[model samples]
Target: MRPVDFEYTSPTSIEEVVRSLADGGGEATIMGGGQSLMPVLRMRMADPDLLVDLRRVPELKQVREEGDHLVIGAMTTHHTVAHDPLVAAHAGVLGQAAASVGDPQIRYRGTIGGSLAHADPAGDIAPAVLALDGAIEISGPAGARTVPAAEFFHGPFTTALDEGEVVTAVRVPKHTGWGMHYEKFAQVAQSWCIVAVAAAVQVEDGAVARARLGMANMGQTPLRAEAAEAALRGAPLQQGALHDAAARAGEGTSPAVDAAGTAEYRRHLAGVLAGRAVTAAAGVGG
Candidate 1:
């Protein structure tokens, strides 16, 4: 399917991109890797007057360490994030999640910024980012600002971005020695996750000191399993403790029923996956 006629502009600088979006008002769409936007365009889901391309902005394609966080440029591809040694060392859960997105070709073209901006409830990266408590950097006509991952997604296919704002980078605090895992359940190898869990656990003296759990496709937005986290704090790293914590995984979730499964089924998967993910991160067996 061919998309409607639209003006396209590739800007070399973040400032230029902001100006282009501001000029187009709300009739402009920002194009990152085009992995998600192209499909939307082909389906006529979005008919913007202009397409502001960010490919020419080199600064948006870098990965570096800054202070306590590892900053990843929005244009960094999933393949790069999945393979970069720096990312693997600092945020292994993010790398594992990126490796699970789509197939090889999709990972080669999909951008981290693009996935976060698209805010798909089933996207693999969102849950990992949410679990890591990452932050998103944005640039716009007004200026630059940061939004925490928890506050970034408003709902499925929705975000906190305002008109003329483009995501420039993502910042995640270094978790050099933490145990992390991304657990996903899908119908096929490259299909969207029916339910996914991202877990990061910090152990102390054979006990679960801190745990972060993020759920994918469990709600309108990627959600943190706060109740599960509370239940696991200071608990022994054992099968019983993991199951007890995971039982509360669906406490505050509102999952949707679709062709993949019913709401009840997803809620059940949430608990089961959470237990597996947490135990795996903690290096405990059931």
Candidate 2:
């Protein structure tokens, strides 16, 4: 079904968007690349009275580095994120995840900020951002604020974004020289992840100095494998130690039961993929 009739405005400035949203009084929806929202609209899943498009806002389409963080604009497309040299250099895991977001068409139109705001548990970007210790920038009538990726996701399809607030950018700390990989398991190509792992490893003298692991489709939200990350610290760069650390990936988590697989099966895949992700990221022989 087609979306219901709605007022639409393509604002060129954030202030105009914010003011329009305020006037909408909780009946407005921000449109980024619209790759995700259009489907929702057509299905009648959501029907906002006003649609505020951000495409005309040049400020929201940039990719730049500030101090020690890489700030990616909210409207930046997945295709750009996947191929941008700066993203590849500073946040390889995020870039890798962007590359795996969908087929070429979806990647060309989907935006990272839109994906994070949609907050799909199986989405590739959120877990990668969480593993990178990134932050989400927000703007609204109340002014702007930043929320860390860990605190940004509240539940599946839910986030810390208040009504009328738009995600302006995503700030990720630079991780130069770090080994990174995004491991995903899907029923078919371009399908959502059944279970996926985002691994970033820092090695020092043949030992794991630091490790960050985030798993998708294993809980209410994308979750960090704290147990596994803790165990990997100071562990030798060997398959045995890596497997031991990876085995803890499923600890203290409850995944959902769905057509994709059972919760138990998802948990099992988490552990197995954790091992593969960490091994490849840390440069250990598979």
Candidate 3:
């Protein structure tokens, strides 16, 4: 099934892309690396009348630091992030997650903004971003606005992006003293994760100072296990506390049944992987 007829526009500027999308309104879709959107179009899952290509927009291709956050342009490819020393030093969680997205070819072409905008619950970056409390910056006719990572994802393949808006960049908080771990359960390297966990923990004197845990493929969106987080707060970073917290990892989760894993299996995995992630972040796991 080929895509329906559509008008293509390669906007050289972010402003041009925003205006084109505004002009076409709901009939338009932004194209980044086309790793996800192309498949959506080919299968007729999405049939936008206009394709606003963002390849020419230089604003969407930067990686820099601002204040306490690392600002990454929406068009920066996964390959770049996975290999960049700056990203590794500042946000190793994202770098680790980016290296696991799809395969080498996909990583080379797939953009972080595209993956976040696509909003697949199984996608790697969403959970990592959620764990990091990242922020997304968007541009539209109304001007620019920043959205918290928790509010960015609304549901499966759904986001807070309104019509005519484009994600310009993502701001990941600087991981100065946090220990990070990204643990994924997949049958193969390129397969989607059945259950994955991204954990960021700040430990001091063998106690958990702060913990943010994000689990993927556990619900409608990348879900942060509030129960698990609550359990870990101010607790001793020991095996007993980690196991106790892991039990609550899937407390409020209702994962979808798919070929990858049953809901029950995924729920069980949430517990297992959450333990692994937290343990790893606490520097207790290999």
TM-score, candidate 2, is 0.98
Score candidate 1 by lDDT. 0.93
Q: Note the residue pairs that clash in candidate 1.
A: none
Q: What tens digits encode model 3's per-residue C-alpha lDDT throughout 19-115?
A: 9998887899899999998888999998888999999999899999899889999999999999888788878888889999998999999999999
**Winning model by TM-score:** 2
Model 1 spans with C-alpha error above 4 angstroms: none
TM-score of each: 0.97, 0.98, 0.95
Model 1 C-alpha lDDT per residue in residues 1-286, reported as the tens digit of each score: 8899999999999999999998898899999989999988999999999999999999999999998899999999999999999988889999999999999999998999999999999999999998998999999978999999999999989999998899999999998888998999999989999999999999999889899989999999999999999999998988887878877887778899899999889988998899988898899975
Error of 1 at 259 (Å): 1.8
Which tens-of-lDDT digit does each residue in 1-286 have in candidate 2? Answer: 9999999998998899899899889999889988889989999999999999999998888999999999999999999999999999989999999999989999998998899999999899999998899999999989999999999999989999998899999999999999999999999999999999999999999999999998899999999999999999998999989988887898898999999989889888998999999989999985
Better of 2 and 3 by lDDT: 2
- Number of colliding residue pairs in model 3: 0
Query: Cα RMSDs of all predictions?
Result: 1.1, 0.9, 1.5
lDDT (CA) per prediction: 0.93, 0.93, 0.89
